[model samples]
Target: MFLGDASTLLSVLNRRLPELGLVRYVCTETSWIESVLFWTDIRVGTSEIVLLQSNITVNYIKRKSDYVHEPISRTGLESIWRKMIELEILAMAFNPYEGMMAKISPTATPFPYRADNLWKIQSYVEDTRYGEKYFDGNFERSVEIKTRVGSGNFFRNEHSFPVKPYFNGQISKIASF
Candidate 1:
């Protein structure tokens, strides 16, 4: 599935809706993996930044028949949300991939999550006759968002800012991510 900025996504979704052939879209909030976490351990002059990684998979079977279940009702949506949460928690707490980490990391070299790598191209300018144009125009391609956990500061790949400022409440590191 293509994941991108919301406004761009809305236009993309509108264009692709015809392909789905569904009369309507059942929009659902991200109840699982709700936010990306930028967890840090505080220190005097510096701190280490590590992005929290938790993954999960959800499978829903027919309760009675093969009909597609439309969770339009609050109760139905709640049930689905709860099931998603349960699966997410199970994966995070147990870390099912732990046992296979050694085998996968050393040998397989699986595709990595490159979301954080976007920081490498925070801002770019192209040569124009009149002046340089910002890649995102005047808008920031990425923006900082509060964590769903509502505690520590977290950032998604889209947000364009350095990681070090959030460490000591000071902008010691002016480097853009």
Candidate 2:
């Protein structure tokens, strides 16, 4: 899904995250794209004030001489993961939907420090091969680490957040490296 914001998000991740070993082995399949779409409401306690959010899925592929292969690398995939967190953190304050910074309410009140959009991870998987169960663990870890560091704004400009264990749910379903 080539939404208007897709390219912009991809660029941010590539430049900021770079190649690190943060990619979980779970996403090491051949180059693939995951599209995550959802809606979020910025509410006042329980009242819905406004709805705004973004869905970004990353495509992981290996880099070769003047060519890119679908086989994902640990470094390449990790970079994508790092980028996702970075984008989400920015999303808290910036509203891609409106092409402006996010507001605290629909009244156009400027958010103190960019509104923190309440987000949830639905799933990240290779739809062609396996179902939601395949990437469940890795997706969980990704959101956990992102939310943890985002909560503190830790190293916000860089992808240096800590990571947890590998998620290999039903190893039989994943493609071999």
Candidate 3:
């Protein structure tokens, strides 16, 4: 999975996205875009436009603390926000008391979040195909990662992330090869 940002990746997905129907798997906490649209308070407007650009256009919207929504669960969350192709997706991660981050109250004055809009998740799936997630948006490619970062961070050059590879003790195994 080449990870970059949202817009950059969505552009690619729009270019030649795979053809597949789906079922969705997602955590209750993975309701980021939900708050943005449904919450009204977090809706994208003039000021919030930068948030959209950062979260989607740049692809920095991988996680709340600069992580990807893959390693935690296999919830097919993307399907929720946008009209997906009806593929079976599994989305996992923290909805609340499980993960490192905490869900913020909509009315909190100094809204604490890593990004302009916080959409935190660990992992998700599409049908049987899986996406082992992480917090940083470092997928197999740059375009996908960039789309989440959005245009604001992209233009301002603030789009960057530290990715902790899920080594799974393979490092020592690879040395023997």
lDDT for 42 in candidate 1 is 24
Q: Give the Å error, residue 169, model 2.
A: 22
lDDT for position 158 in model 2: 43
What are the lDDT figures for the candidates, one per model? Answer: 0.29, 0.34, 0.33
lDDT tens digits, residue span 1-177, model 3: 223344554555556654432112321222445544433333433355566575331122233233432342335444442322233222233333211334444366464543333354443222112231543433434434443333245435433431211222111100000
The local lDDT score (0 to 100) that residue 128 gets in candidate 3 is 11
Q: Which has the better lDDT: candidate 1, or candidate 3?
A: 3
Q: Model 3, poorest ten-residue lDDT window?
A: 168-177
Specify the poorest-scoring 10-residue window by lDDT in model 2.
168-177
| Deviation in Å, model 1, residue 24 alpha carbon | 65
Candidate 1: 10-residue stretch with minimal lDDT = 57-66
| Candidate 3, superposed: residue stretches over 4 Å from native | 1-61, 64-91, 97-109, 112-164, 167-177
| Evaluation by lDDT, superior candidate among 1 and 2 | 2
Please give the RMSD to the true structure for each candidate, in Å: 23.0, 18.8, 20.3
